[model samples]
Target: MTDEATQRLQDAEEHKKSYDGIMGAATEVGVPGALGLTMMFTSLVMANGVLLSILAGVAVYVLSHIIVKMFFSHH
Candidate 1:
């Protein structure tokens, strides 16, 4: 009984670890993609000139860069 409980806890911990890893990876990519798409859509709708388009592109790039840095994996 004690051994079974220990094994169950170990299994649960393993599952949780894998779940966290998957979610971490998903966020690292999904967040940037979502942000970039939103920026692009808004830029398309709001930008009416070359200068505004250029500014929107820069804004998208900077925001994506910041998100990547924050979510970057070291391992």
Candidate 2:
């Protein structure tokens, strides 16, 4: 019984590690800007800034592009 419990715990740990690995891979290869744009747009609208919102949106787009490129370049 004790041996079986230990094996179960080890199996759970291995499954967790595998899931993390898969997620890490997906994140590296996934789309870059949907969430960031959503957040930036929401904030801009909430704050009600015109010029600042434009600048913020542009900055987020550019930064997201650069970051995604840097990560996906290696793979």
Candidate 3:
């Protein structure tokens, strides 16, 4: 391969590695934080019942993971 092609490939690999590291870090911190926030929000907002609140909290947690993954996975 030419010098420019090799350089571009190296740059792409570096970028991918950086992105993976960032996503890994985000997952490490974001999950527990999201769970805690979901619990808090559910408790405060859905005072009507326990089951519904727990369900809402789970939904929030799942949504947070999805959002984080989608945001980080894309360029």
Candidate 4:
């Protein structure tokens, strides 16, 4: 171990957080939003069709994207 180890630790602590761009923020919110809206539509007025199917696809994509971004973003 060297005397500069503490300095290295300090530098590591100062590292910047990962950037969540516009699309990233959108996915994180949009996935749940779509899922909720679908549920609401199903509950009220009682209608089902392509809207629900599309929301399902979006939900899956967003969730997988989030998982991949979370687990594989390390240096």
- Tens digits of lDDT, candidate 3, 1-75: 699999999999999999888879768567746785768576867575777677767777777777777776755
Off by over 4 Å in 4: 1-48
Error (Å) of candidate 4 at residue 30 is 19
Worst 10 residues of 3 by lDDT: 28-37
Better of 1 and 3 by TM-score: 1
Ordered list by TM-score, greatest first: 1, 3, 2, 4
Which is better, 1 or 2, measured by lDDT? 1
The residue-by-residue lDDT of candidate 2 on 1-75, one tens digit each, is 999999999999999999878866555433435645665687687895867776676677677767866865774
Clashing pairs in 4: none
What is the descending lDDT order? Answer: 3, 1, 2, 4
Q: What is the lDDT of residue 31 in candidate 4?
A: 57
**Model number with the top lDDT:** 3
State which candidate, 3 or 4, has the greater lDDT: 3
User: Residue 30 of model 4: what lDDT?
Assistant: 63
At residue 63, what lDDT does model 4 achieve?
68
Q: What's the TM-score of each model vs. the native?
A: 0.57, 0.47, 0.50, 0.35
Candidate 1 structure quality by residue, lDDT tens digits, 1-75: 999999999999999999988877666656666666666667768756656755676677677767676756554
Residue 49 CA displacement from its true place in model 3, Å = 14
Clashes (candidate 1): 0
What TM-score should be assigned to candidate 4? 0.35
Question: Any residue pairs clashing in model 3, and if so which?
Answer: none
